[model samples]
Target: MFRSIITGSGAYIPTEIQSNPDFFTQPFYSNGLLLPSSSHDIVSKFKQITGIEQRRYVSQDLTAGDIGAIAARNAISDSGINPEEIDQLIVAHNFGNVAAGAIQSKAVPSLASSIKHQLGIRNPACVAYDVLFGCPGWLQGIIQADAFFKAGIANKALVIGTETLSRVSDRYDRDSMIFSDGAGAVVLEYKDTVSTDRGILSASVQTHALEENGYISMGSSDFPDSDPQVQYIKMKGRKVYEYALLNVPAAMKDCLDKSGVPIQNLKKIFIHQANEKMDEAIVQRFYQLYDLPAPVDIMPMSIHWLGNSSVATIPTLIDLVKQGQMPEHKLEEGDVILLASVGAGMNINAVCYRY
Candidate 1:
């Protein structure tokens, strides 16, 4: 049987580190009113809830496409495949190329095209495109690549998720602390595997746009005097938490069931690094469905330091673990793992994969 397998992965982490104390001097607002709590208390509570002590932000000169291409180059080099041989190049991003201090996103040629040009990929048959599926964008790209491989339209693909959430975040919103910047890429190749236990097995994706679409949205800054014409990332934190807690676990369970992977065999879960508590709860509930408690170290988290880089989280986590950066979490041959995510559009998805 033909299967799509990830051959190489890479990630680009920003150099600038913005720690929790960096926001102490910055004022925060809610409902056009200054927060009653002091910055110290607010930051402390924020860390308690989200588990983010610091996050990376790109230097002023960098753009999402730039970082994405760096990651893609690394992935290609890791795969030991010539760039001209790649069949498809998929770039997953939200705010295309938001400048350091700008609210506008420059995506005229599409981020994928931009990355393609930057990489000097001369093959026209290597079609490149962009996807905007919220935080699940990278995984969604993987799903699409799998479809293309099965359909015989492509045999090799490169998927990248890049975001500069720090550029789109509202400085006056406390939730801004959850935003970061990073890029990740993976090279996938179609192979004829004698067994079905070594590649992507199954996936489940859902979009609840009716009532949950507005949970994570864009709006004017919380500071009353800021220009209303400009928009920034905003979220109904409680609503998102509740929605994800209720739905993500079920989606994961469905994917696992379809893959026929026994519950006890799930070695690692690389979930989106949106919120620490929310992810923990979702995984715990996922295990509960099988009448078992969630296993320790089943989930390797980078949120405490990386924060939420939107679509870049899962792939970046994979690259880190693959590179042996995370000593406590490592993938071995024949290990079964799941990749899951939830984000704006109220989209949720899970992929069952074997290493």
Candidate 2:
């Protein structure tokens, strides 16, 4: 069996860190009946709730594609691979540069072309495409790239997850408090001989309760309303929390079982950095529900600092790993790492990688 290996990873966070004070001062919430709270109140509430100090957001003119391109270039460079060697580029994003038009136009290809042009990668084999699956998009992209490499259809591929969630965020809604903007990318390469050094071990994905609740915002075309408010993201926070807390740990166990490994054997655990409280709750419950040892190896909760960058969370974690910010938690050869996430569409995914 051909296994997928992650060669290099990179992440781009905008330099502009937006504090809660910045959010409260904006005039976007002025018209709402509930007066905007003071900056101190907002900051204290957010810090207590999410455990995040600050988050990065793009400047007014930058798009998701711009952040994605930067991350992609850095990933390619980090892998010691020339851009021309890339055979495919897969971008997982909920927001892109262009508005979805009437006739099936996706912005991924264009974004890929722009990246290729800027990097001077003029290879004829280059192909670019986009996948939209909310937070699980990057996990799906990893599985897709692995399958393609296994089939010998592509020698090298780049998978990226970028989201300018602020663009779709309802500034007036407190639910928006948990979202921020960023991008992350990883380079995958095919190798005939599998080594114990690095690569994916197993992956599994499942969906439950995919009904389109008002919680997840579909594009404007789905609703066909001129009201700008409807276009912004809205969610039933408690409902989503219920789904996440229940589903994520189960998915993690499933992936570990499929890989013939025990959850206790994992060297590190990377869950979607959605909510800090949810994260803590899941950890506590997983121990109680399964009679397993508590997960001691945990990655930093990025949502508080990075906000929910949708699918970018794991890849950004990868960047942090490479940067030595996350101390090596005994991830040795043959040791396993688990990645899990849940997103809109009520999707849940889990994958195990052996390093």
Candidate 3:
């Protein structure tokens, strides 16, 4: 059986950084600002709770697809493969392409298709599409790519996760402080490995179908005089936090158990950069599921420095670690890495791979 091996990866984070203070200082048009606490205590409380320091936003010219294309180009370049050699393109994203200054998002044509054109790929046979599995989209894309490899449909594939949450975020809303813009891409090639333990070992995805109602949503904000029914991202934070803590670790344990990768064997686990507290709790519970103490270094997070970029979180973190940007964790040929995410549509997914 052919195995999918990740050959190269790349990431793109916007240059604009906005800290918590930046949000508090922004002009508010509405009276009932979400900040019910003292202005002085808001930042400190936010830090104590979420652990996000700042996030990046794109300038007025770039779009989600633009950043995704840049990351894709870098990934292909890193892979040392010609663009035409990529047999598949899968982009996992929340919002499609939202221009740098635009307030709306659009996915008229798939970002994968856009990146294909940007990379100057002329092969009509190269399959290109997008996956919208919430924050799990990118990992889902990778999983689908692996299937193509196992089915003898593609020798190599480019998978990407990109998002421009800044466009869809409600500036006055507290959740806006957590959203960011970024993209990440990886190149996977078909390989025949002698070790059955290496490469993609196993993967699984789960969707809580009824979750769309209250957990998280993106659409019109209720503020008056806002863009008439202008859509923006919203969330029931307590609900999401509770649901994540309850379901995500269980899913991780399930994937690890199915993959036969013991908790002690996992070198690093890259979960979605949604919330620091939530992720930390989930990781702790994950180790408990194996009757092991949670190791601090087992999970490396970019949420403090990068904020939450939705689906972009996992791939970007993976690319950063692979590029030696994250010295806290490293992947070797025999090391096992766990990729997981939980987000909108009440979606959760995990993948086990030996690097």
| Each model's lDDT | 0.94, 0.74, 0.85
- Off-target runs (Cα >4 Å) in candidate 3 are 27-34, 195-197, 211-213, 222-224
User: On a 0 to 1 TM-score scale, where does candidate 1 land against the true structure?
Assistant: 0.99
- Best candidate per lDDT, number? 1
TM-score of each: 0.99, 0.86, 0.95
lDDT, candidate 2, 1-355, per-residue tens: 3567778889998877876667656433323444457655765776787776677778776677878889998898889898778888888887566332212224745666666666677788988778777788888888888888877799899999888777676666666667888889999887643445457778888777545344476433222223543556566677888877777777777778888876667777777788888878776665556686575555555666687888888899778876676675434557678888888877788889976
The full ranking of all candidates by lDDT, starting with the best, is 1, 3, 2
Q: Which pairs in model 1 have colliding backbones?
A: none
How many backbone clashes are present in model 1? 0
Candidate 1 local lDDT, 1-355, one digit each (tens): 7788999999999999999999988889998999999998999999999999999999999999999999999899888998899999999999999988887999989999999999999999999999999999999999999999999999999999999999999989999999999999999999987675589999999999998989999999999999999999999999999999999999999999999989898999999999898899999999999999999899999999999999899999999999999999989988999999998998999999988
Q: Each candidate's root-mean-square deviation in Å? A: 0.8, 4.1, 1.9
- The regions of model 1 sitting more than 4 angstroms off are none
TM-score for candidate 2: 0.86
**Colliding residue pairs in candidate 2:** none
lDDT for model 3: 0.85
